[model samples]
Target: MQLRSALVTGAGRRIGREIAIALAQGGADVVLHAHTSSGDETRRAVQQHGRRAWVIRGDLSSRRNVQRIAREALEKTGKIDILINNAAVFFPTPISALTAQEWHTFRQTNISAPFFLSVLIGRQMYQQGQGKIIFLGDWSGRRPSRNFLPYCVSKAGVSALTQALAKAFAPHVQVNEVAPGPVLLPEDYGPEQQEELRTRTPLQRFGSPYDIARTVRFLVESGDFVTGASYVVDGGWLAQGHDGSGTSL
Candidate 1:
């Protein structure tokens, strides 16, 4: 049987990298898309799995670039069996300091880019009669955060987009989302802050990137009946309220 092809956006580092490699391990050729072109390690990791890996670099925040990426991936791989919208921008946007530029940038990358990418790729999947599209969402989307207002709102949009596409794509394509919580702490966060996050999590621990990656793998490979669902891989963080005493420096 011929292998399938998958395209993973923002797949140069962190959770995106793991998702790309996991898909390759599942016998799929991968088109790894990186914005700002900093995913050499991710490309190497996918190639190490003995699957063909193509690196396509572009800023998904731009509609032209988004279209170019979809076109290039299909051109190189011949088919797109999976599309993972994993690239996103996370930043603090307290209501006081929020600016129009900040909101536009965040919305364009986090919401508009993913929606457009899904529409284009989904059309291809519909024609193919079988494909999967996974969006990387966040727990903050369900439970809003005071500081990261725009990012949380953007992810909430992602969650809704997942459901909308699932219905629109129907029996031909499967659309779903994996929402992760505190899997990887920001670079400046200290041990005390990490402990606080762990305490809030009912599981009392942080989740690894691999944990999110595995959930995505399952949805893509084994989740035939699953569509329009948001899988929470938050180590139970949403089970409790947020206790804000940490400092991000």
Candidate 2:
């Protein structure tokens, strides 16, 4: 199916921003959402590609907001050909100090939000009889992270959700996942930590947001027969059997 429009969440910066722009370059109008940030720049970039760009600012953690996301996106562009469930909150939640609030936050943002978005949007795609849904998961999801207990559990749920949704929306909506690692360093990551992480990866290098963006494009633009797969773009980190599974440097 030709991609006429895409809804990208958390697209104010980093991977989400790149994905939004890449989709625009691929000739799809974009609707970008962010919880606390502005997607004005991303919208401008998408608009620069001669495609319409709509910005929606709301917290995915809110069920009301999640319910309205696909509705607003479809209202803007009339149809949503690509649904990128990319909004997630990542943090370290050691089992020892894991709090109920922290776990709630992780599950709400990382799991529930995406699930709601997919159900609402997937039904639309099914009705149209053609569409693609790409969930942004985590590399730690495949291999559990020692320091990110809640996050790992949440992301693992996403992996399962991908497979379940793929089956539920079969023959119409192709559901897949992109699990990225070391794509962008955190603001608090130090140089020593960065170097250590770089050496641990089999690729000996971190990934760029565009790297993930390219992967997302391939999933939407091609891969018609592919679904229920979690594609990890982690510089071979997981394959190397590396002990560094935490989402930080």
| Candidate 2 stretches greater than 4 Å from native | 245-249
Off by over 4 Å in 1: 1-3, 241-249
Show the colliding residue pairs in model 1. none
- Each model's TM-score, in the order given? 0.95, 0.97
On the 0 to 100 scale, the lDDT of residue 223 in model 1 is: 88
Model 1: per-residue lDDT, tens digit, 122-177? 99889989899999999889887778878888999999999999999999899999
Q: Give the CA lDDT, 0 to 100, for residue 72 in model 1.
A: 97
How do the residues 42-91 of candidate 2 rate in per-residue lDDT, one tens digit apiece? 98999999999999989888899888887888888888889999988876
> In order, what lDDT does every prediction score?
0.88, 0.88
Q: Which candidate comes out best when scored by TM-score? A: 2
